[model samples]
Target: MPRPRTAPSRRRRIAVDHGAPLVVAKRLALVGAGTSLRPADPNRAYYPLGVALERGFVTDEQHQAGIAYTRAFAVGLRRPLALGIASDQAEVSDERRAELTIAWRLYSAALAAMSRRIKDDTDNLVLYERWPLWLLPGHVEHEADQRHRKRVKLGLDVLIAVEPKIGLAIRETRERRGA
Candidate 1:
């Protein structure tokens, strides 16, 4: 018989950097392949965020706040904020699309809100198509295999890709002195 897969239990996880429960220190960055909208399937979106947090890459609090910030950026927690981003992107002929975009943002905000309250695989986040549209897979199985490879290759591809964006983090890790 196979054991049922489940997320880890909630607890005050210690963060190596600040000496605070990882559940407390605050910050996060969303890598969306330059995507601007909130993802439809947040579980997919939250995976990377979860991994980074679990492995002590980022403090949990920061992850929470960061996700909230992204959510707010997407849907605008304040009416003025929502309106400002909306107006900035709105055009005379694209009013309908603009409204849809706002709706998308709101949906994203709700997802982030829910996601932040938990600690688990679902709570941590990410969202990337197995392959870009330009490189569509020959079949769904092939796509799954590719995504798995990407997950395994994350250290080489995504981590390295993030080095420039997260240079400070990369540097700090190296300074820790590992075997």
Candidate 2:
């Protein structure tokens, strides 16, 4: 009888200057390139407001608040799309319209707070607003990128101060959805 093979471990111990967790075992960056196996990049992030969360730069409350802030922006800025051959504007429910109004208020307030708190660095506010659209696979080298991390934390802190309920609301919603 042949012996059963065990699954390989996801993490491999390796010498690294910064404390970054290794999540992936192997993946090809390009289709036809041959390269040595490398751990997942700590700097790269995909999901909305995930980079700071994954990097351990923000607390759970802060992260949840940040997520809510971003989501509010999305809801507030949403527009009815006219699909192919259908030039009619989709009607939104009264409740949904109210929700959009609330989202706009929340987004405006949070953004104002962040901008006010970091008035010295206007670029920080710009970075926070455009964070969701950042290019992927961007390297977040240590030391050099510490300022950016600090700015993120600051922005989240401002949101937390402005609306502590955002995080609580998100947590409750997630619980209801079993997420």
Candidate 3:
């Protein structure tokens, strides 16, 4: 007889070392409020971006740029009006609307540029949405993951270009760090 399958657990166990400067294998620095708030043990929680940053796949500047893009994207997208709310009452100022339009347009241009730079469909997805480029276990050594890392760097270049201020700030940070 066929055995019934059980649902997989949403939480997974991960080893974390609180003392390490880097998050390689053993690090407890990535836990966020969302992860810690869950019923499951807090140590099991991990933040994908923090892992990515720690792994050196994406720079701090790139991370900030990605966050900015996400915020702009959210602002660009139109939200559904609450039931019984009048459209006139929910409208934003002209300047705010213009800012939103520009933000989305910038995101669109960056997307197109990144699409050109990253040819692989999966790589593009990783650049656009999927994250934590470094996964646990032996996957990091695979050729595919290496390629993903390269693509992520390229895509981040495009994102950084879209937000020049972030690049400038990054350069300043590097100078301060003597890097």
Candidate 4:
């Protein structure tokens, strides 16, 4: 006969460095909230970082750093850790929830584009610049509308900023194949 499993006394734990800059705590909190609120699909865990990049909420460097931090934080957790964090500890503000909703929407739009084989540079440019009109037709009128144009610009900016990183990954893959 096998013994039954038991829950750990502590679900999650982190040590504080009081001497560190305030941004350290803020970044940890951001990663914690992001990880806790992530959807069940593990592959989509980084979606919020992409959304943050798109909205200029975080710079490319910060997004990259946050990804490392978030993954580390996640690796230390047990299965029920997020539930305890969400229900008993963390106080998720309405504003944070609203931000998460926007992130989800942006991620969903990206996934839709990927599914449609819009992964090339030209297709990405078109999709990002015109996504608002197609994805939220009720809100955007003409492509020239200020609101529509702003959304388009924001999306395009994110794509442009991240493109080099994507290209580097592709180059690395090609090099590995050649080797």
Best candidate according to lDDT: 3
Pick out the ten consecutive residues of candidate 2 with the lowest summed lDDT.
25-34
Ranking by TM-score: 3, 2, 4, 1
What TM-score, over all chains together, does every model reach? 0.21, 0.44, 0.49, 0.24
**Model 3 agreement with the true structure over 131-164: per-residue lDDT tens digits:** 4334443354768877766776676567667666
Local distance difference test values of all predictions, in order: 0.36, 0.46, 0.50, 0.39
Clashes of each: 13, 0, 2, 0
Q: Model 3, residue 108: what's the lDDT?
A: 58
What is the C-alpha lDDT profile of model 2 across 1-179, one tens digit per residue? Answer: 99677666645567665523333221112111222553334333433244444444456687676555544444435532111111222455444444544654764566566665443222232223344222123554566356555665676676667674544554564576566
Task: Give the C-alpha lDDT of model 3.
Answer: 0.50
Clashing pairs in 3: 17-26, 17-27
| Candidate 4 lDDT score at position 9 | 64
Lowest lDDT block of 10, candidate 4:
76-85
lDDT of 3 at 159: 66
Tell me, by TM-score, which candidate is best. 3
lDDT of 4 by residue, 1-70 (tens): 9977667764445677576556554444433334344422222222444443443444566545434322
